[model samples]
Target chain A: MRTLILLTTLLIGACSAGPQPIRYGEDACNYCKMTIVDQQHSAEAVTLKGKVYKFDAIECLVHYVSPLDETTFSHLLVANYDNPGVLIDAKTSSYLISPNLPSPMGAFLNAFDDANRSSAVQREMSGELHNWQSLKRTITTRNQIPN
Target chain B: MSRGLSLILFFFLVSISTSVGNKLHVGQDKPYATIHSALAAATAGDQIIVHSGVYRECPVHINKSITLTGYGMPVLDAEGEKEGFIIEADSVTLEGFEIRNTGFSYIEDRAGIRVKRKHISSFRTTDYITLFFGIYLEHAKSGIVRNNALHGKPLGEANSGNSIHLWYCADIDIEGNLIRGHRDGIYFEFATECRIRQNISEGNLRYGLHFMFSNDDIYTGNTFRDNGAGVAVMFSRRIHMLNNLFHLNWGQAAYGLLLKEIYDAEIRENIFQKNTIGIFTEGSNRINYVDNDFLNNGWAVKVAGGCEKNKFHWK
Candidate 1:
């Protein structure tokens, strides 16, 4: 029983070891090269090779991952907009796009782990609520207009 | 004489008589049907002249050191495709064309013209739709990009790109271009020893000119107006900013010129007018600000903490 418990603990620790904490005002975004100033709209991604990529905004993270195969990444983490520096699973998080809530990159998209919190913000902010896939699709579609 | 001897003599004579460079033509009624075909047929030091017409095609990749000149501003429309032109060879020149519709991609830094060690001039880019970059230079050295007009859609920063973007380049010259309505009009990252002069950058979503980690650069006689922020020089050294105009850049978080983590720079003979902040400095050292006009700004100059050995003088 002790051996089984040790194995379980090891597995949990390995799984929980994901992205690192983003250093605000120092670390630059991998996509836009802007300094990561706001923690609320920030994101971090860990590749399979254990490379960490930080983003100043959720839109920057989405744009960086849009052209790649999503399965290659080990973890996609986003910071809670209300609680700074707290990361949640990006795949399971809910997002709201509202002009009232300004982001560092001006996309105005914020992430929330709880659906009820997202809905509450949506009611207050009056913008569209979306899951990860839908939000990615929306950004992709919006950027694909012919010039 | 034998037939083989006669054929050999004819070939030798032709080789001796042919010139070093040839001029190829491409248009609706020209010899070649498409620019790609003309480029394929051209050799080094040759010239390809394209007449005026609208063409819908893939990105024209130039791998040879040739001059591709267009007459009457022929339009190369990508039509939501990837890119308009990709010049990979050194000493190549692309001039006088209307390059349009380089569609945006999340994965790729799409551009109307992507060059490495080339000279680009006399072109126009129209942003009927949103796109990434207008002219993107990567790892290019001693190149020239001048006399271009780039028009971008006035999208937010999340969706838009820059008008001229340079990455890891050095000793390039950018002059006499008119750029508008992108994330940043001119963006440089890890670029060194470049010269930017006499260009007009306006209505950008971000700063008109954004510099990051670039050193030994000089910008003179440029105009940056009505952008989200006028200009930002960060993490750099030995920069010279002279005789430029920064005007009407107003926002809650904006400045006519922002200097951060910079050293050994000269900011002189510039005009800053009607901006949210005329000049904002942070963590900079050993800089000279002389003979610069600050007219009707929210704050003329805001010096943050950690700055040292900076001198400011009025005209």
Candidate 2:
């Protein structure tokens, strides 16, 4: 009976879907009409209903999710620059904003899995490193500027 | 000799001298094993031949007028570094190379081959993304790009770049190239008097061909298929499009051709099939569409607000 339970648990764990790879030439951004080609600058959000939405840039994803209610999305993910095509939890990842590191939508935000690497890049590229909360604040502040 | 005879003889002699420049070889057996070294040793009107091998280098700058040809299609792999080639001289010809893996950068415009001046041909780029143009021409006058293949892996508009991008260029000829999976297959920004012919651009994320603020350009005998936003010609005058095929470009905002703020253009003898909209026009004036075939499209032609003096003939 215990062996049967363990087998079932393993099957369930394997079946759970996590972050998916953004098909670069094939997948279009949900917000912008542009295709998602930048591996390091892309974002993905999974809704409560399990529908995944991909964004070309982190700014686009932020802009899209900012207007929604907190309960709408189940997960938000960002690509790690050190490892291309790998998604990490957006809330936990560290972001570096620099003029030298230009993002797809001119936001110049890059995500890193390691805080030390983020700080290293910050030293070289001359930018401020921020967590998700601080990065959101900066994005909101930038978006408030009138075009 | 007679004056005319002497002039003809002199011209022939000059052509012979120009064509008979010294040849430099770069191979395992040759004195120079790297293209960079061969290029450094070469002068104007010389020929540098690269043998078959994978060369890991970035930003191969060509500043002298010379012919750089490869035997057995030497691979110039950038390996996700910087750009592959940068040409800055006049009358330079580059041919037969497999240039690949230009790293993506938002601030810099990286490319498989960037021509600031002069000519290139018979090259290929495999799978680039995000502001990495396959072939780029900037401020160049009178060049030719032909018989090349450019493939991109575009996921979004902000990340993808144009396959063949031209800016502030004039009298350029682009022909016989296959471009796929880019933001735009061919993009002309402020480029004038260019001719695009016999190229196949398909499966791109944005328009197969995009022209912005360009004038007096002619595109003929090209195929554009399965693009996202389709083809767009905007803010241009005296443009001629003939004998082109636009097919299977279907999306909510897609059209076979979108003309905005264009003037005195002639679109004739083209085929538009299986597109969301065959032709979408806005703020365009004095344009002529004649003998173009439109079949199996969602809307044949949608003329939006502020369009004037346009004439369309079914047959």
Candidate 3:
């Protein structure tokens, strides 16, 4: 009984779900078929079954998840534009579409986990700010490649 | 009359000087201390010879029509900070140099050697390492990128670049290049009328030769081995694939040659050996698969839906 309990606990611990680090040069983006090299603008999505999908840019994450059911994914994370390689929650994050900041897949989108910090950057860079749904609508409406 | 005579004399002297092709030498012991100084002093139709040394510089922009040749294989190291050379002018011939370490950038697509304008050019580079893109050709036409060897050791989870990247270019020749350990060995997007021949592209992290939206291209006599995925030609038209070898590309979703949304391609006399899928086609139309050998692949030809009028000539 003790061995069974220990084995179940170990299996559950082994299968624990979280965001894996985006290997910049190694991992390929699941959406746009690019190598996920950008640290500041990449993103990740975790399904309810614990399957992780990585993207090279924030817009790719939005475009990929836009048509899917909302209940499919348990967590959606975007890279903090201020902090390179740091993944933050996508639902609560604020987005800034600044032409001054270019991304890997050419969406001109930047994400910040903090709203106040995103607004401050917007003040400095002088672009539009958006929430999750607005950003998704804007990204899906327009084409992906701008150049 | 005297003023006209003097002006004619000046023009005669300038023409004679330029036609003679002055040679500027750059070395530690030569007249010029740096290649930049030599380039600044050089005019059009001049030849600048760079001697053997490791020179750390970013963006050695060549704006004049000149021949920049290296003696004894000089090294231009960017130190993972910036690009190596940005060739702007036409009729530029760059030969015999080792360019390495064009550092990674998130905002910009940096390269070891970037051919910007890309008309009537010749680039013969030796080796490159740890770069985002090895040789990038943008808006270029009628150029030859030949006999270059690029070896990349990519950083952890950082975005890796392609070895030879061509964007919106046309009528270029990519020949005899040995590329390994990149995202894609040769990548072409919106490029047209190009020829990729006699190149060995192996062990890349993505497709060995990945081209999209290119038309009227010819790829022949190349060896693509052990790449993450093999060659992928998507959204292209009137391409010719002849006498190439695709071997040992194995993964769950990998293929020897993947064709998606392609139209009117002639694929002839190629060999695909030991891959997960030999030829995976989707939405391809009017393609002729003639004399292609599939040896020991998981699936010889896995046809997805929406393919039309593909003639398979079995030899």
Model 2: per-residue Cα lDDT at residue B131: 30
How many Å off is the CA of A88 in candidate 1? 4.4
For residue A31, model 3's alpha carbon misses the true position, in angstroms, by 4.7
Q: Residues A1-147, candidate 2, lDDT per residue (tens digit)?
A: 999999999877755555677887557677654556677788999876667899878877877887788577778999898876778889889999897786655577899998999999888889888998788778867832111
lDDT of 1 by residue, A18-44 (tens): 678886545667765565655578899
Worst ten in a row by lDDT for model 1 chain B: B121-130
- TM, every model: 0.67, 0.67, 0.79
The top-ranked prediction according to lDDT is 3
Question: What's the C-alpha lDDT at position B136 in model 3?
Answer: 89
* Candidate ordering by lDDT (highest first): 3, 1, 2
> For each model in turn, which proportion of the native inter-chain contacts is also found?
0.00, 0.23, 0.33
Candidate 3 residue lDDT tens string, B88-123: 999888888888788787657788888889576554
Question: For candidate 1, what is the DockQ?
Answer: 0.03
lDDT against the true structure, per candidate, is: 0.82, 0.81, 0.85
Query: What digit string (tens of lDDT, one per residue) describes model 2 on residues B4-119?
Result: 99999999999989776799999899889899999999988788998999888677998888888888888888888689888887778888888878877754778888887534
* Candidate 3 lDDT score at position B294: 90
Candidate 3 lDDT tens digits, A45-93 = 9987778999988988998999999788888999998788889999999
Q: CA shift at B84, candidate 2, in angstroms?
A: 0.7
